[model samples]
Target: MTIGFSSRTSRVARVAVCCSAVCTLAALAVATNPEGAGLPFGTGAQDAKAGQEPPSLYRPGTQARPRAGAPRVPRDVSAVSWLVADAGTGEVLAAHNAHRKLPPASTLKALFALTVLPGLPAGLRHTVERAELAGVGAGSSLVGVKENRTYRVADLWRGVFLSSGNDAVRVLAALNGGWRATAEQMQDKARSLGARDTRVVSPDGYDAPGQVSSAYDLAVFGRAGLRNAEFAAYCSTATAKFPAGGWSYDIQNTNRLLTGAGVDRYPGLIGIKNGYTSKAGNTLIAAAKRGGRTLVVTVMRPRTGGGLAVYEEARSLLDWGFRAAGRVDAVGSLVPPRPAAAPQTGPESPPVLEEKEEVTGPGWPAAGVITGAAGLGAAAVALALRLKSGRLVRD
Candidate 1:
């Protein structure tokens, strides 16, 4: 049998066939490796991967989603996940996709600092060895540490916060034995602090498989870090001397909210951390004080290429949080650290350490933000649609 069709119908048929094929591949891709699919929580099989849940501003059981009474989030805010909480009370005031895990980029550095800062003496100095800098990921950010140059522990912390320096993280991780050890410690610390969605695979927060965190957890890190005078000081420093000598390098805080460089310096803004990678997009955790009330806001994976979008989104959330204070009931509370346990003497059990205190979305994809093969399939469908219709169709 011969199929009869007009020119327009033929073109349409071809387009439809192409779209169908692309979508099938996308579906299959998502089906095969659902976990790697980067879909937001609650949208795909990935969400069911034990311990994951849908993003919601209101705490679980307050309501399924944000009610009209909740603070109004800016329509223009582009992050896939965000949250605001009372820094002092650990109360999560408002959030969107607060529990959805995504790549953290350099923002994970905050956790690194939290895990290792207490162990290293501020005045302790170590010579930067060539091996310490080796194996840093390509295109990673740096504070220009040079081999053979000795740096104070405090200085390295400053680099981590100011320059978002991968080099600084590497050196410090080495001081703790190695990056792997530091990452393990960071993960352990994250669990103890109630950051349920964090998995620290890289000490420097470089993009790595399974290295993920949620907005809620990032805020937890900020709040926990602020308890440490040193963590707070390092993050808040607007500028720091990289090497204290003639070859001194001035590194500025990458957090525009504090610096007011590419964006308006947020009033009452305090130190925290921000991060980005092609995979992670833009992420930020910001803290500010107003009328004795301290609020920490975290935004992750905001739309890329919009200058200052992350800070702007954070500012919006902070404003909403302050306005909603005493008005909106908290959906959840950031759990306080586990109390220090007395030393245990057993081959199987290690001694517990004391705790230090500190300060501190969007939508689901239809196929649930499929990543890896699923992401490629989605890309194929999008590309085909764009080519055929000359209009962008985002998944």
Candidate 2:
């Protein structure tokens, strides 16, 4: 199907190109750090295999199939794409066009949270700086945090998850560095999580050029985010308060599911995120829990049908997921796999790491060490790495 890809085509193309480069540089950084990609995380084959398989696969005429005359799987949105999963098991219950890339709008924050969640310092207070207000066109839902404002790192996350506050996201991004650096890091995290259809061009999920992700990728992020008790608690909130200048601004969650509107007008609604733009119409990531079962749903570019089109799609998907596999005890094994003896566990002569003498992108890469640059820089690095291994380009 032909998407109405706008003239911002250059921006989107540049994002893909840049991310390729960032991936290359990130690989180099890890290699140079001597830690490789195996820092605290175990580098064993078993650890790598975890979360790599479908949570559950149904066999025809098995107990896993829905009962006779149970609801059929939902239809895929025409312009939109989606995936539904059993969150507890990380098993994809149903998916349509799961690999297709599309604008994510504010839903990009789902990933923004994932990148920062691991690093949030316990009980650390961060002062919001004036320079953090750098991005243009932050929307109306700001915390009204002033220049030189102070807030707890925890509160900043609350603002981001609950209010979808662009200003809060900006402050967090600025604290990390500029959006350019933070976005590069975000893409790296998304890659590490195996989100093949995602790229971040903005710290907050603004309708910026080249900031796009697929429904499948969003589902992955939403599931991951829910695992964070803090984020889950934040999203579940219907209202939040941030006070300044002797007054408190009461911010409400934009997710209708939390508001008991639209498809949430049904039952068992939990929380996630919502997004929209001229390019990306009424996108949503939603989840529901009933009888100890959790399901995540994402939809993008819903046909201009109506307001709750995306929510309706989500509800149907959620219902199907519960029926497809009713309350599996586990998505992944809770017990750790038995350890296998390493060929040589004592770091006996670290594996010889290879470095290419030259690097290039689609165009030529200037002969230099991979530096963290945005857009084209990232793409160039990915391309150079590909060339070093003599492998054809693959997304």
Candidate 3:
């Protein structure tokens, strides 16, 4: 009896009513806005708060206390979180523990793609990297790329998505500078994009102590990745051929949503990424487009099983999102709750915010806002916890 996003839609009208009743629970989460009113113009914080948890948004069965025999939304495959969003508008569509930072496994390639696509000269080709073979550290997956072999940057991009090629990623990272500098650049790019909970410790999303990202951060990466037409095209490919020592080898996409056989199908599904480890279990970041609307979904540390659970969850979520987005209103009135006395202002504090927070403006914790918004419908507020920041308690 797994509760699903689609299963919840049968009660959308009820959800709307319930939302009007429940919005006050979150009023204290807002800053300085006593009325908890609609967003103010150019104030990014207001916009993010508006998006944080919509009044009408409903996800099935995410209440604080569970009813007996209730179907549980799957836990992440790792100890971290996950998120989803619309690539075109960069709107968050769904999330699960989106701010909880944890190892990304190979999913970090998406960021590698983002960093490489924008900085490199246009039409630059990839050549087999000499260092790719000489131990780029541990956890390397072999796509059998021959040392010193040459391929187009475009071709390597396909390898990165299809095979989760650490070697190829190392080559790309090294091309920018070195792994250390490349990782730093990725951090910078993440910061610029407002991925507050994201921190990179490796060129590959390997299991490093501090290498982590939230589902929200991944969604941000996904949104940014989609902007690179080449990377987007590469990720969509189920298979790619690259030359190695004058011969061609085929690499398959690790993302089961795109190429996995016998999985529940998601209509309009497009490209993204997947990850796994004994510790991480199964992780995935997927995207799809329907009726001019696009959505991204990330599943981290999901229940261990046939590995089809991720797709099943994804399929259900996409179905619900497409329907919900069409029928639901994105804006609503905020019920003013008794303030908890605004985090205690100091004598040095500036009055009146000094600067009013702008909507969709810079510096808001994008990861928290997006993840919290995605969890609104599901009642899964745990999705908004930031694990790296020690915000969410571990189970």
Candidate 4:
């Protein structure tokens, strides 16, 4: 007992240093305050604790345990932003630039599906309107939703999950009302899910002027999405038949990790989403289970590798996360949804965050008051670990 107390006191003295880092991260949501970051000011973000926003995520580089027994985070991760988390427990195994917002690409569709799928019944069929397909961005992916063809909601979702179809997303958004309203509802849904970094300018996740999300937010979406049965079925769906003009044909999931279409099929992979654009590079959210443990990994814009790097990086990270589990400490946690409460005000029609400055490194001097939150929010910083800094994707 004497030995244990001595060890504890020394460890506490060391970790007290990083308390400031988590404090900066808590204040990093300056945009979340008055401007609201598409969220109501008091969505409990400031009050959130218990590693709700893990401190090391702001390290601007790789984060891992320094102790001898702790599994190291993969050195070659190379993505601009990445995160590996326990889907079952919401413990973030590790992260890099976890909340540094960037364009999300089609991975945003997971949130779209999560937001809209619950309300629309699978058996409900709607005829495709020309207007619904009209606004799909040029060169956006398509699951071939043809105009005037009646499609069951299930079919549209199959198109979305299998093909990453912007056309299908537009149609689904229209059925939810219109693209704009669906975007609002998506924003509301994101805030409710504690995904503050996401700004859903297009339900399809096209690279609009201000459209962006972070690897951390994507992991949150993936973890929450798996909890919903329909979302899980759609994402895990490898292939499905779609109706054409008078016939039907098959479509395959673009998430190569799930289907192994062109990339190596990751064993025990769960279907999530993948996306790319000239602007976003490559982005993915992948989940897999092994030994009864499921891990979710999100990679946004790996800048250092081949075209399939997103899946490869996700696979590698998932591998590391499993290896690092319990060996390395959780840097943070996936915060649960804020309890429903009346907003201080109504939804602002426009996205509130359009910050010009980016937090490319740690301690970039952000705004907001972080009291009682910066220190060990979810779990204490790993006592045996020492952080090392490194510098670093797309989609």
Tens-digit lDDT track of model 2 for 12-35: 555667676666676466444432
Best by TM-score: 4
Off by over 4 Å in 2: 1-70, 76-79, 138-141, 261-266, 326-395
Best by lDDT: 4
Per-model C-alpha RMSD: 18.7, 18.9, 19.8, 17.1
Per-residue alpha-carbon lDDT of model 3 for 244-354, expressed as tens digits?
A: 766787778877778866774456778788876555556677889998988777766655455676666666656655655534322211122233456447898544332
- Arranged by TM-score with the best first, the candidates are 4, 1, 2, 3
* Clashes (N, CA, C under 3 Å) per candidate: 22, 9, 26, 8
Using all chains and alpha carbons, the TM-scores for the candidates as numbered come to 0.69, 0.65, 0.63, 0.73
Which ranges in model 3 have alpha carbons more than 4 Å from their true place? 1-80, 121-129, 329-395
Please provide, for model 1 over 181-240, each residue's C-alpha lDDT reduced to its tens digit, 9 standing for 90 to 100. 888899999988868789989888899999999998999999988888989888888987
Clashing pairs in 2: 17-379, 18-375, 18-379, 20-378, 21-378, 21-379, 22-378, 89-331, 360-365
lDDT of each: 0.78, 0.67, 0.61, 0.81
lDDT of 4: 0.81
Pull out the clashing pairs in model 4: 50-377, 50-378, 51-377, 51-378, 80-393, 280-395, 301-393, 301-394
lDDT of 3 at 149: 69
Model 3 lDDT on a 0 to 1 scale:
0.61
